[model samples]
Target: MKIEIAEHKKLAHSMELDVRWGDMDAMGHVNNAVYFRYMESVRVEWMRAVGCEPSPKGQGPVIVNAFCNFYRQLEYPARLLLKLYVSDPARTTFETWTTIERLDQPGVLAAAGGATVIWVDFPAQKAVPLPDWMRALVL
Candidate 1:
């Protein structure tokens, strides 16, 4: 499915993270691993916005594949604005898009990327078709 950011109502989601001294390497900026945490925040917020409860039982969307592109640097005590949206859902997977931007500069996007996640049956530990309720929400 294709998600158009312009068509959806803009929702605000943010996560405040403390910059651990260890987060900085020789370059003195947050390590690459931290970006993944930012992405996680966005995903959690997006799930909440769609009124989907996170399945503690693991019978929910599973990240079959994911990737991220970093455009800039982030420092200590940084507040990140995670903008997210859901695209179309396939038989077993759903597409999602996200952008991490600096709250201080609203127009400057720090990173942008997308992911493909598959719905799964935790009991069976296997991929499953998208639920009707999830498809309805995306549409």
Candidate 2:
């Protein structure tokens, strides 16, 4: 998706990831599934950076929607710089954009993606409105 970094919700969090050899696929590049994990790492970190504690049982945000666009091949043993910024937050859901780039090539983006996650009431197995305290963090 086309996102202007300046237009994001202004919460910024960064993380460094070491690509493991096993993270590569037979095609000789980082596996697509690994990208999701990378993104998840950033999301969790962002929430922590904003001072939101994990749910009591350790369950966190639920992914209601997600998509990624691969711009370049990411190989193993490389350092990935991940940045996450909130996009928008509704009463029950929030969105964020994540960008992963090789540290060696800061300006060259390897992948870009975003996810929409909904707060959930686990026991009820249904969506729940974000609590006021949680919404305060994003705002």
TM-score of each: 0.78, 0.87
Give the Å shift of residue 17 in candidate 1: 5.9
User: How high is the CA lDDT of each candidate model?
Assistant: 0.70, 0.82
Q: Residue by residue across 34-102, what tens digits does model 2's lDDT show?
A: 999999999988788767675645435788888888989999779999998775779798888888998
Clash count in backbone of candidate 2: 0
Compared with the true structure, the alpha-carbon lDDT of candidate 2 equals 0.82
Clashes of each: 1, 0
Judge candidate 1 against the unseen true structure and give its global Cα lDDT, from 0 to 1: 0.70
What is model 1's C-alpha RMSD? 4.2
Q: For candidate 2, what is the TM-score?
A: 0.87
Candidate 1 per-residue lDDT, tens place, 1-139, comes to 2223656423334444445666676888877777776677778766776677756575688777777777778776566667766666788887776777767867576676767878888878888888898876555
lDDT (Cα, 0-100) at 51 in candidate 2: 75
